[model samples]
Target: MERDLSRQELTAETLVLWEKTRMSLRNCIKRVMRSHGVEDHKVWGTVHAYAFEIVKLLGTIDALIDHVTKGSSTREMHPWVRNPLRVATYEMKWRDLKPAIATSEAVRIISERVGDGPARFANAVLYDVEEVTLEEVLEKAEDEIERLSIEYSHPTWYVKHLLDLLGRDELIELMKANNEEPVRYLRVNAHLKDPDAVILALEREGVVVEEDPHVPLILRVVEWNVPPVRTEPYRRGWVTYQDKASAAAAYALAPEPGERVLDACSAPGNKAAYVYAYTCGEVELTCVDINPRRIEEMKRNFKRWGVEAEVVRADAARLKGVLNGGFDAALVDPPCSSSGSYNRTPEAKWTVKWRHVRRYAEGQLRILRGVADLKPGRMVYSTCSVTVPENEDVVHRFLSHEDTYSTRKPDVPVGSPGFDRWMDRRYRHHRHMIRLWPHRHMTEGFCVTLLEGG
Candidate 1:
């Protein structure tokens, strides 16, 4: 095993890995720390906070780097140089670290990883960045879109999209919420443990939680001295961390005892597990996804939550001959740009593009069609995306093509109605869809729609 590295070095390494692989911050941190043989939760928490915040403010930090480098963008720099400078700049600007201390640490890491020349170059950039304020960078933006883009650390296109969807005031509020620490929720695994006992155990373990009024099984985490995963309740599988909006989807689907259900594109299987627990493991479930790694993860999660299902590794969009259809109900939670989850996974704000949204919309329609072909009585189409194309537009297109299927209002009562109009068209059934906003709902940006047909 490799020797353990300091938190700063670990954060730099994790940032570089995230940039190179475009993996989520959590996965990158786990890989980096595991490689270094480090298992300290305190150190992991420090590295996670630093790395996530740095990535969350990447657009601003990169702009500062460009300003200091006299127009040479961070894209031109080596990962070792770029990521370390990001860490250093984030510390100096956001964390209020002294420039000298942040620069010294960054340069030391760069020197050890690369060489003295690049380290000296990084040192020069940090020295220049210290004098440049974020306001100066924002003032340089040519227009409002670019200004908001840099200020909120979001892509230019995304800023424009949100501005159009939400007016100026609401957009700013959503952007601010996206930058804050994501809210955490724990769902009591009622099948495996008593809900009252689980809540008592969590409180005993110092995890403060309050029950969600709309959804009884869901608990909003108020505060915690220990990480939820480290708590004995979580260890005993009495509670699982899930977003409130996500838990709402399983309830929206509302699979009953002995109903045949399909979880299309399910991976890491939170929804499926919730369904199992909701029905007390009496539902006949089949979960499908194309990724092998996620399939393995879903299996492990099922084992932990005591969920049983027919797990298949296959493309959900092309599930015709691989498995039998005729599911009584299905949850078609397709892969999406994850726009709604930017608050929890800030890296997505930088990586997701407009074209990717269109692509996801296409794939989402295909999965819905494939699952519809299975002749389920009802299906819940959901995504952790607030984008219209992936939510309403896909549903509209699917309903248009598959005349047998029609939208119904989901039983979920907490979220707002979906957008009825997109571009030049009007979706008649959009009123039946549900949308959760981070700013308004205190949940991940999510969309859920129930359809009954065939």
Candidate 2:
């Protein structure tokens, strides 16, 4: 009983931190665990699962709380009271925990942490939440967008945005896919180990995987008795986890051996490492990123994969005097709204807004213009986003200003063409851009466009 109470308290505290800091949920969990000196993997796993599940359904959960409280918003409540109530409501509704037990645990935690008044309030809220069903709250939605948002736990604005782009049936499919468990893929490091040998090693460790059809050396994880990271093959760096669509971006770049390749806005450099592995360490790689911590992480990753590259710490948007112009190929993978990655990073669904998407498109255009000045023979701009503004519009805006470069159809075979509608007229080279959908591709939504210098 005490163990269960501790878990609830820990999860509530983690949620409070996430709300306060607005950092990634995983990072917030790490901070809470470290502060409590909690190192048990079992506890970590339990807390992680609970926190992520609650956060993934935040919109729905908050709506339920608001409905029960009768016009009171969860945002107005104290974190101590609010988060504990959220944790309890999730347990009751989603985890199928006995309402009495879930409410009792939440009230106990709130009473111990805040005081009796808040605890009493939380108990009343949970009691009310217990009587209501999610379907009841969803039925109150004023429109289809709001209903879909509540049902799938996405922001209402984002649902409407997707509906505008994909229409009704496709938008619902995407929302359903976003709420499901994300698929994991492994890319065998063919530079260090033979693909067959890596597969044999993974199977020996009780990991079931199958080859991805379109992308060479990529495998879909079927089942695993042991975590892949703890397995021998992963320990030896023979295989690393990467989405098949992400790996496709590197293939689109297709840097040849002995050519100078620039990876802009690249840190935690998975794609750059893939390029090195693709060329068997023969490509001259230079990676640029602004974050020091991610740069260190990328360095560690490079060492593990036997990859060699020059790391530069600077903004990709303003690279003059920091880098030279001569390069055979370059990859411009700037950060964006990350809408396509909501399944894996559900926190982003709440954090990113339409305004942020417009800002991202602006920033993406700047990075493209900056990188284009360097005159790489070929460049691929990619983002883990499904929005038109960040993909096709950014490319269109860049090409409008920069006449020296032209769009080329990405060599990769998978994914659909970019949307052609721009201001009621067709974008000139919309077919040159490729979009991978989570519903269709079983991968994170991604957009890739290839550009060539004359």
TM-score of each model, in listed order:
0.97, 0.97
Q: Kindly give the number of clashing pairs for every candidate.
A: 0, 0
Error of 2 at 71 (Å): 2.1
Candidate 2 residue 91 C-alpha distance from true site, Å: 0.9
Which window of 10 residues has the lowest lDDT sum in candidate 2?
Answer: 1-10
* Model 2 C-alpha lDDT per residue in residues 96-196, reported as the tens digit of each score: 99999999999898898899999999889998999998889988999988888888889977887778878889898998888888899998888899888
Show the colliding residue pairs in model 2.
none
lDDT of 1 by residue, 1-454 (tens): 5566778889989988988899889999999988887878789889989998988888888998998898688999888889889888998998998999999999998898889999999989999999998899888899999999898888887888889878789999998888888889988878898888888888998998999987768999999888889898898788898999999988998788989999998899998888888888899999998999999999988888888899999888888888788789999899889889987899898888899999999989988898887889999999999889999899888888888988888777799998878678798987899999999989999999999987
Report the alpha-carbon TM-score of model 2 versus the true structure: 0.97
Whole-model alpha-carbon lDDT for candidate 1:
0.88
lDDT, candidate 1, at 166 = 84
Candidate 1 error regions (>4 Å) = 1-4
Candidate 2 Cα deviation (angstroms), residue 328: 0.6
